[model samples]
Target chain A: ENRNNVDSNFKNYLINLKNLLFIYLYQFLISLKIVFSSFIHRLIALCHPEKSIKNQIVLITGSGGYLGRHLALEFAKRNAILVLWDVNEDANRQTVEQLKSQGFFKIYPFKVDLTDQKAIKSTAERIRLTLGHVSVVLMVAAASFKAKSILDTNFEQDIEMHFKISYLSQLWLIQEFLQPMINKNWGHFLTVSSNSALIDMPLISSYASFKLAQTKLIETLREELIFNGIDGVKTTIAYPSILKG
Target chain B: ENRNNVDSNFKNYLINLKNLLFIYLYQFLISLKIVFSSFIHRLIALCHPEKSIKNQIVLITGSGGYLGRHLALEFAKRNAILVLWDVNEDANRQTVEQLKSQGFFKIYPFKVDLTDQKAIKSTAERIRLTLGHVSVVLMVAAASFKAKSILDTNFEQDIEMHFKISYLSQLWLIQEFLQPMINKNWGHFLTVSSNSALIDMPLISSYASFKLAQTKLIETLREELIFNGIDGVKTTIAYPSILKG
Candidate 1:
């Protein structure tokens, strides 16, 4: 009897261990599935907007900068209601003018500093009120620079600029602009981001560091808001190398 | 003579035409190269870190939170310095205590409010004083629960908290920690980011927005800092699904 009991107990322990391992594996696989699906879906949405993107208001921030302008034009060409937000009023104006000449009426230019919460909120509110709903937001605005070494990098100024212009502003914009889409059961946000967030580089410490933080913030946010996607809100990110002279 | 003059004019016109065509083609090829290389390289970095982790720090931020704690432990096991920065005193203490018990003396902890510039600066300076050089800085600390929906998210508070903790903190840490690393020639900054930044979610608009912004910021930053990896510092990012829950 004692021998039987020992055997049974050992068998049960193995069974439980097997079950736990399976459960863990399942979760891991599921999470991976979700990630890959989300990523592929986003690419399709961005590259082939013509296939289908209904009831979506696309907001492209920093539409003035080289990257921002290119993305803004792409979104505009896709017939997206492009909201061009930039701190550089002149650049924003130039983009707006060019778009206007190109017959882009859906394009809205807002000269707002991404660093300022109030500015972001006000602008988002304006878009919500006027546009009725925003389905996609493309955060393509940011500060950029190059350097030989991190020691030579303007640690304070450059890094601060990255956080304010690149990182923080997107948060403010979403807080102010995204509720209606959530309620309506349809929205997607797209941002132009960088691979630098993953790998580290010498001169652009500020840029890479800030980008890394933002990446994680979204990862957790994805889990907490899975139900929200069920409500029709999807967030997407694009990490492209900078294209500039 | 008139025919000869006409021929010369035609020749000049043809030369001008060729020049214009050459310029246009060059521009087109450049754009294509930029888009394709960036897209492929970023995808490679995201999908295959081990194969491509040249000089990246491969950071895991929020090294003091519940998930951050586990991540820090994992990183430590793998020989990471365990750059543990957090706002939670107890959490940081618990992590440090636990790690110390496990024989991890290299775990570095700091109490910091990501939003407070002074705090960020001071903490950074303290980090610099302690860890002379670091390349990759993970952004892990973030405001939670109150992390609201974009619409429900407070304008001033949401942006302040998100950017300060999630975005700005990265900037400050990198500026202070990476100077020496850059001089020595390398780093990688990864984040324990959410899938939400991977896709926009409705409920956690604040989190999503901040994450999205950070994502976008890093994407652009990478463009300018490409040489960091080859020259000295490299940047890379990972968008993991929630860890084995």
Candidate 2:
């Protein structure tokens, strides 16, 4: 009986050791596969030359805002035709003036409310009639941030506003432009989502939720585009950290 | 020159080998840490006994729907008081009847339009006045899924309905009940999010986006509760596979 017990104990020890080794090996291979695939993806992305946007009609929403103004300037420098949309008339005109002063003459400024779907559709139609089809859309507009917890935030006033700006506006714009982009077989969507969408923070529940929704919208759009084999139309989502502006 | 070239090549080879070793070690350590932590968490959860909900007031939205009816049966079996909310009056009454036939008398059915804020508020108030404070909320309500791609989906009708049912209703319900839950220091929030939220799927963009938003809301709520040192209130989000219901 003592001999049999010793043999069984030895067999169990070997089995446990073998199982532990197998588990570690499986984990190591998974890690290796992940690392290798990511490395290859980065390498491929680096190999692709930057696409030129010269003379392309680039529609930028929230052109009155700080990031929008900067993006407009950059696109202008690249010789792309800028169609700037902003609800604030003064700020929109100021952006147009700033671009004109810099000798960027292909700037079209439209004072449009993103929250109003009718205004967005009409303005988009007008742009298409006048300026040709827009090939790129930069969604940079976001509702102003207010530091309030979920309990303190009002649903209709605060949360709805965020939902409109961060989510609904993007939805409407994408709906307006995506069909044309697919027909043309070349377009780009640059969605400016915030870091709040990816992280947990205090007192920004409404902002974070809608921002996350925006990210999901863009993500699903990309997936659908890919599923349809529309490779020419690309979507990029930027999750920028908190900015001073 | 030959000796110098050989020495340089050898040095470069050694450096590359060192970097490769470092990278593998770092990845391995990360994987190990993740595995160890999850194992410990599972062990801790297993050691803790399940909490009893006998005679507790449990509010379940969408009680007229398939999952809701089944949940109603389960909770009734557990001897918990069920407050069922559904826009379909007949279906809600049927759920109550089913429970009653099963010898569960503590069932309350309310015909409330989740899309209407006023109805939800008033109905919630009535529940509070008549049935004491609800200790558990099961958010299982969702808009019916239509397999239409983003372009085919209408913003006002289809998307808005999904947003109202999936995201807004949860927001309103949580707002109504959370403060009371905090006061009681014993509450549980169970959110039934769909698998679409986590996976990339075509033709369900609207449903997926709002479901993701629902998840974010619950996550942020839990974080906020933790930040406030309110550990008694618990939040759990479920990402179930596609259910026929």
Per-candidate TM-score against the hidden true structure: 0.50, 0.81
- lDDT against the true structure, per candidate, is 0.62, 0.85
Tens-place lDDT per residue, model 2, A29-61, is: 755665676588779989998789999999999
Docking class of 1: incorrect
Tell me the spans in candidate 1 whose CA falls farther than 4 Å from its real position. A1-56, A146-156, A229-231, B1-245
Interface RMSD of each: 20.0, 14.9
Clash pairs, candidate 2, are: none
* DockQ leader: 2
lDDT per residue (tens digit) for residues A27-139 in model 1: 46755665677699878778864434533577778788787777777777777777778889998999888888888777778888787778777877787788767677777
Candidate 1 per-residue lDDT, tens place, B126-187, comes to 65576555556666666664644434555475656665555555555555555565567666
TM-score for chain B in model 1 = 0.67
**Which window of 10 residues has the lowest lDDT sum in candidate 1 chain A?**
A222-231
Candidate 2 Cα RMSD (Å)? 16.4
What is the alpha-carbon lDDT for the whole of candidate 2? 0.85
* Shift of residue B181 alpha carbon in model 2, Å: 1.3
Candidate 1 lDDT score relative to the true structure: 0.62
